[model samples]
Target: MVHTRERSLLPTEEPLSLLRKDGSPVEDSPLTMPDDDVLLELHRRMVVGRRFDTQATALTKQGRLAVYPSSRGQEACEVGSVLAMRAEDWLFPTYRDSVALVTRGVDPAETLTLLQGGWHLGYDPYEHRVGPQCTPLATNTLHAVGFAHAARLKGEDTAALVLLGDGATSEGDTHEALNFAGVWRAPVVFLVQNNGYAISVPLSKQNAAPTLAHKGVGYGVPSVLVDGNDVAAVYAVVREALESGGPTLVEALTYRIEAHTNADDATRYRTSDEVAAWLDRDPVDRIEAYLTSRGLLDPARRSAVAAEAEEFAASVRDKMNVDRTYDPAALFEHVYATPTRHLREQAAALAEELA
Candidate 1:
């Protein structure tokens, strides 16, 4: 059974930072913001992620990839959170979190291969320490909790960061994971990208709670809501929470600003005016403005960054077209570390049927 409780507050109100919207700083945000170099890096990653998402969507439309969930406006939350992790840390990502995987050093080629259904798994989990993108919604949260629990038992200081959407918070697995993490004091960070929609369901319809971060209080996990469009805020919150060494939930309140996936048409549920309002507060634009105001970005450098991102996207597109075929017999390889007799018989039957 899951243990549910009320959400608790951080020691300070500074956790929820809404700074630097529309190219300017708000009067009341965390005083210590990121340095110029760090800000530039955030913008760079955001650009790269956006470019990758565009390319992936195009590939999916071309029938080269099976599916894609674009992180168009949500780049900051993913890149910033992933950037806060140490090299030794583990990341649990959802299908929409390819940007996080990319930032965590997963190869784009392998990621595309996994998305295209060419491989059951992408990169070797041991090598990259990045697990396969969990497509089954909030179920991966439990895996993150369990992994952290095991690591704690083994006396490892490593942490696990799990990324999911706002819609996922409504799932039973999410609640169970939170309860487990809180009870055991697991070193897990739950990063909820509240993009305002869980496919067709709006956030209002997903949960009646005022905020997802508040839900963490009941689980004894400290939680905060941040302007998800602001990469700096995301990095700061995640970095601090990871250092605190217990489960924390960051509800990044941002909008999708794009379709749920290539298969989804968000216009059916949301209005164009809503999408336009979010576009006005675009994460990429905010960073660009900040960089420009500080003289860290100029027209020439901006053009170069865009060109480089495009080149990277083009390379991924070319790589996705390359043949990376696998043997039909290998389909049964990783189902179990040691295949059971039942599985073996089923594999043989399937192989004979195909033949």
Candidate 2:
């Protein structure tokens, strides 16, 4: 009963899933799996990404980080989407997407700098091809669309990917960005990690669309709904979207296993039974199970991955545990291309105060 013409714009009837909860492959999916080596690498990165997420959370408790939004259960979406991007492509991540930043080769400690209350951005966006870890919802989508359009104008093949939450879908900026991208055919991809709740506001209140992907149809963008916890499925769908030569919207059905951040209590809004249900479908465990079942991950390999993750976590801890010192005047230096007289006066006064 599906219409052929609109099929390209609508998401699949069900969230596209390649692997079941038990680690068995779904037969006859049109999506193709990456090479075995790539799959193994995905598993390794997911392990390390999860560890970095946990370590960052621990640092928050120890008073090293001012706050951290844990992406613990969402590693598959975080790692899978980043790995799908080419080196030339740019990524626009939300504040909660530190794991994606890490997967994109950003230093773990640097990625947490903003959350640590130290810097506006922890790393150089130009060098890493990543925007600031955006805190304002849906604003990055517009930035991504503009960047992609500019790249196209310059005759570059570069594209952009922007990650968002379900709540962002309701923002005016998100609507504008999608409309612009669709009209211009900008080489941008919108990845909405629908992690059930957007900081305690369950998606039932944020969106009415059958799936977040369906929102794309109204804007003339092709849409895909995928099981966000399935790393391979996320990788494949995002890769296809990037290669589709136009803006596409992908809705990944995942769950945020942790509280919204160090500041929020999840128990007040959701039940432990709900959390327990998702824990059984844990993304990291599913990938590990599949790999082990295929003999690609034996005890030795598994142990090595765990050890590497632990070492990575230790490195982040060592780097973050130190006192962070900053010069007050340095902030004024980057604020403007040409400092205003008022700014200069304030900077001089601050310098005098410090002296």
Candidate 3:
């Protein structure tokens, strides 16, 4: 499998960005800064997403959630990428992208359902234009490409935003989907949240490329790299990619401050210093500093946001405390319209045992 063909690492162009680590604006982007309202909304969503992560992680520790993946330092990626899409666009998320679901207006309680070992996806995909979060890596791209290509075939102008981790870029399905997307001119944006790891494996071991986004270059898809922690940068880059009317690949340089999940210990792989460096570049803090410097968010406004976040965390805890109990038999209910003979017998045996 090691055909070491040396393909030129040629990419479409440089990545887009609009913010510095200290929250200063970069004058390079042709696009002007987002308006006050847009900035305000971004800040609000980042705050809410962070609080959601905090509450979900706490629930996992309390045994309320079966498992939880915390998107702590990556709020900007979830909020900015999701917000970049138009009303008609679809979002294909990963299991870790519960925050993306939250950004799209899905209830915190319901969005955490599958993570808490509840029912299948709790939201309606058609209504929200968001597909359920996929647990299998790189498979979501297949769904995104198929859905987007079908939309174009049907003469609909809908685009799809698919989120994946750095590890997913290694999967054959990801490569095939990107290759097909370019050939078919599918209006789908592939966003790789390069959080440095696929569980315990770091990006260095994931694949070899000048950059992960370069993989899409072979397929004739334009590529964009951006600082994933910068909300403004991510939102701007993703906005243009989704609107390009063709496939694009965006590699966001971000870090996952938490473990891969509640069951995995990140300390076994990463260092405290590495985590601290990313914590210094925290997305929520950067925007708050930027807005505060411009007087957009004063002390009173900050207090209001704190109160709102606290209320949200309290509600999530309360809802999870009395959330619906998990039923083992419910798994087979929606799996098939007509149960197989073997499945029917198992169902009957289980029902009889329960009775």
Output the number of the TM-score-best candidate.
2
Per-residue alpha-carbon lDDT of candidate 2 for residues 85-171, written as tens digits (9 for 90 to 100): 999999999999999999998988889989987877779999899999889999999999999999999999999999999989989
Residue-level lDDT tens digits of model 1 in 1-355 = 0013233554244335535677776556643477778788888888988999899989999889988888889998999899888877899999998888888778898876677888788688878888778999898999999999999899999899999999889999999999999999999999999998889988888887668887887888888788889887788778777776789988888888779888887888989999999998888898888789879999998988899899989899888877666778888888899999999998999899989
What tens digits encode model 3's per-residue C-alpha lDDT throughout 1-355?
A: 0112222224335555577778887776654567788888999888978988998999999999999989988899999999888999999999999999989988888898888778898878888898988999999999999999999989998999999999999899899999999899899999999999999998888788878888877998877777899898888778877877888888999999989988898999999999999999988888888999898999998888888888989998999999466567887787779988888888888888988
TM-score of 2: 0.95
Give the Cα error of residue 29 in candidate 3, in Å. Answer: 3.1
Sliding window of 10 residues with minimal summed lDDT for model 3: 1-10
C-alpha TM-scores of all predictions? 0.93, 0.95, 0.94
Which scores better on TM-score, 2 or 3? 2
lDDT of 2 at 277: 94
Q: Model 3 Cα displacement at 262 (Å)?
A: 1.1
lDDT of 1 at 278: 91
Q: RMSD in angstroms, candidate 2?
A: 2.9
